[model samples]
Target: MSEENKKGKNDQFGELVKSMNQFFHDKPVKGFLQTMDEFFRAPFPFQSAFPVEVRESKDEHIITAQLPGVKREQIQLDILDNYVTITVQSHELFTEEDDHQRPVRRRQSMQRSSRTIPLPQPIAENKVKASYQNGLLQIRVPKQKGKKILIEGND
Candidate 1:
């Protein structure tokens, strides 16, 4: 190609690259891509490893989580102040043995997933209750109990 044509082609390629970079770095596009990246990177998209649902009532908060393919022994629950954390851990074992009863190519892997939720009101840790059944976890956190004290000077 002639020098002029070569220069022109190089300029056009550079412009294309600049425009693509600008489009990808734009605020809206970057934000959307970040959101999508997080969703896709999670073990379970939108579920954040597992689905969690919290329901609030006048006195207590009810929290439920879906943990399909998980066992009761693999689940853990923790409560501190007004926050609830649920963690699930599992281990996988693989072994390829020959007929001679010797082990070859043995591998063990561990996986853990967790989620933390904040409650609207202070919880009564002693009064909190949890249960796991059929790969489902339910936690009830009761609001802290307090005696009523009247304030007269402010009125």
Candidate 2:
């Protein structure tokens, strides 16, 4: 090919690359690609699960996590005054039975969920109570009762 033709082709290629880069830089496609990359390289997203609630009262702090269709034995909880972590894992197996001569196909799936919560102050370890019912995990963490600061009348 002629030198002028080669130079023109190179210029066109460079301009195409620049325009593509500019378009992706100004859009969410880059973020989508990043997520896809992470999903392929890792087992789960860093923040996949967000179904949890924390409630506090004078007596104790309660943390409830919604984990429907998960077995009781698959849930774990660790409690501390400064932080609490919960992890839930489930595995399901599906099977098809054939009486005479058909082939049976089975599929197994696994799901894992985890969450971390931070508390204002440390609580007693022995005072923690946890329960799981109806696919809901509930934890009651009793805070170390703090001394009340009585405010005197203004001078």
Candidate 3:
């Protein structure tokens, strides 16, 4: 082939590669790969697992959790022994329409997250108070006085 023909072929090959790269970038494959990479790079125990902070004082224990986009009624708190578990269930619906006014996509998703924290000391279940405000849930439970236990020797 002549020099001009070789240059023309190389230009066409470059254009072909550029177009292929653009096509892949525009497709969902690239997005999926990015999402997967983020998922793997994330630290263990996903962020949606209801991150909580517990503070203990001389009289009471306070627990606070970050729960955005969740309704108060959707949250459930349970105290079993020295463990406190907070669970939240939520459902979201999303719809998209094209220019023609026809629905192009409809998505419904449900998410549930729970986090259990073991208290350093026992609490007074009857005096426990919980409140939710502005996407934050706080629970205050009074600490119980430590009881003395007698150990009996086995005969």
Q: In the order shown, what is each candidate's alpha-carbon RMSD? A: 11.5, 11.0, 5.4
Rank by lDDT, highest first: 3, 1, 2
Per residue, candidate 1 scores C-alpha lDDT tens digits across 1-155 of 79999999999999999999999999778867866785568644223368899998888889999987788898888888788999988777867687997984565657778999998767678888999888789998887768999878965
Q: What lDDT score belongs to each candidate, Candidate 1 first? A: 0.82, 0.80, 0.82
TM-score, every prediction: 0.61, 0.55, 0.64
Candidate ranking (TM-score, best to worst): 3, 1, 2
Give every collision pair in model 3.
Answer: none
Task: List clash counts for every candidate, in order.
Answer: 0, 1, 0
Between candidates 1 and 3, which one is better according to TM-score? 3
- At residue 13, what lDDT does model 2 achieve? 100
Residue 21 displacement (Å), model 1: 38
Error of 1 at 132 (Å): 0.9
CA displacement after TM-score superposition, residue 136 of candidate 3 (Å) = 2.5
- Model 2 spans > 4 angstroms off: 1-47, 93-108, 147-155
Poorest stretch of ten by lDDT in candidate 1 = 39-48
The regions of model 1 sitting more than 4 angstroms off are 1-48, 98-101, 146-155
